[model samples]
Target: MNVTLTLALFIAAWALLDYLKPQFVANLEDNILSFLLAIITLVSFGQVVARYGFNTGWSAALEFNMLAFSWLILFGMSYGIRTRLHLGVDILLQKVGPQTAKMLGIFGGLLGAFYALIILDGAVLSIVGVDKEGGAITYFAKMYKVGIGVEEMKYPAFVQEMFGLKRPHVQRWVVLLILPISLGLLAYRCLQASWHIYTGQCGSLIAGHEAESLVEENRGALKD
Candidate 1:
């Protein structure tokens, strides 16, 4: 689990660096979420076909798919913030001048950052668990002391033997840590969006409505 967290942190750092580069186009969250969705779809469809057509299916398929689905939704929230895909009513913002709008957008981002911070704090508490001595347990302490595992999955026997692995089941706490991680990501994105808005690098905190833009485009076409 420590190794998993380290790897995740490394990937996140790389993603942040890539985001800072002007020419970088690939989105780490988008790529990961897309890959997860693809795997889930394939596994689900295969399971259905096997169960109905071949009268046999892997028992772990549903659990694995559900795990992947959970990760997708959890991570997608921050991705939505990064891409400005989340819906927001901007009627008042639209009426404001550019400078005022930018200020308001920054304030909105601060509010979002605060919200994410609260969620992150709660998630951290869950990940850490409570100590028997009525003290707060750190996530690092919990990771080392806890030996919880997922029930439906196991590593292949050959690979397990080769790696000299003791536990057959996947660790559940590692997956659960995504709660804090995703909330942290959401907070980071909120601050980043606010910074970009302040610097005039982006237009607003919320994305423009696609339907309204399409309608306006069609109206101009009709006039011309």
Candidate 2:
């Protein structure tokens, strides 16, 4: 199925990136997050101005924003892991010595990767599927086949005039298609971080120390 192929291709891409790590692959998540945030901010600002000033606004604005926000959260998780921006208590890590703490952090990273993959098992079977009917992953393919659309954002009359048939709205499958990819990417990031920790290429999985440094950098301004 399409879902299975996509996951497989993603796995291959991950390996390729490890060797090559071209800039585009490295920043793909960052680009996506920036785009989603930009559009969401613009649309929200426009909607408020239109509603209050003109008493009319895009009805689909709210629906669009919700989808964009969901997308932001999904992709942001992987980005956080990739950038080591995710926070952890690190109290136990501190108590341990440097060598022991490094091992513990690496262990936590591997566990994080496994957790992401396992969470997908309910919606997906092994990122592959139990069968057509057994996995929710297949539901995306079915939705695409049936050409189902979101409730809001119907196609305009111009689209019907040109195509000779009206589509209901933007397709749900297209919007939600990021779910599986985001989950897969989260697993990749966790494993990648774990490897870096083990190899001494990076420090803790948690950003606590980085966060402390950032706050210290701003403390003088805050005091002013």
Candidate 3:
């Protein structure tokens, strides 16, 4: 058994667990975000200290930090929706009655899903080059065949040999895969919110602090 391939397969197993247990997936996303954040902070701090105090730093530090930031933002987009952390302007929603607000929220969810679908389509097309014959092919396959690699921080020779890779550099396609994954997650959450609203399990698709709370607080302040 190839140890490298086995390690990759083990990592991929998390996707299966995501489908089987959504809560597990949610926790996984949170943990991944936290780890990325920590890495970014530590690396950036080290880079600063090395540049100023030691008069030296890793040349690839900026590139690695950028990659980490991109991953965090992309993954956090879906996590925000899942945890109802996304801010929404709900003035109109609050003005309406419960039934009307719920219906409008469902409509908004559909629109969000549609927007994500459009983004996903464009990203996929960009990643996978089109054939002259107008045939479509998988981007991952093309990337693998070409052995594309990142400009900086190439993988070690041993890792390349273990994976039978022609290039020692990190694969660009692997990072690009986050585009589809995050978009898919966002679309799924949009549909989920719509369903919840339809079933009366959720009052609104846009989650935020209720307007009534602000009004109540203001009234209490006036009395005081």
Per-residue alpha-carbon lDDT of candidate 2 for residues 1-224, written as tens digits (9 for 90 to 100)? 57868775986687688569757775776788899999999999999999999999999998999998999998888889878888778888778899999999899888888777665545433455544133335556677788888978766778767877557588788887777777778888889889999899888887977688779999999899
| Positional deviation of residue 134's Cα in model 1 after best superposition, in angstroms | 13
Ranking by TM-score: 2, 1, 3
TM-score of every model versus the real structure: 0.76, 0.82, 0.73
Candidate 1 lDDT over 53-92, as tens digits, reads 9999998898898888988887887787777888888888
* Of 1 and 2, the candidate ranking higher by lDDT: 2
Q: Which candidate ranks first by lDDT, i.e. highest? A: 2
lDDT against the true structure, per candidate, is 0.73, 0.79, 0.70
Q: Which of the two, 1 or 3, has more lDDT?
A: 1
Q: Distance from true position, residue 63, model 3, in Å?
A: 1.3
Q: What is the lDDT of candidate 1?
A: 0.73
Candidate 1 clashes between residue pairs 3 or more apart in a chain or in different chains:
none
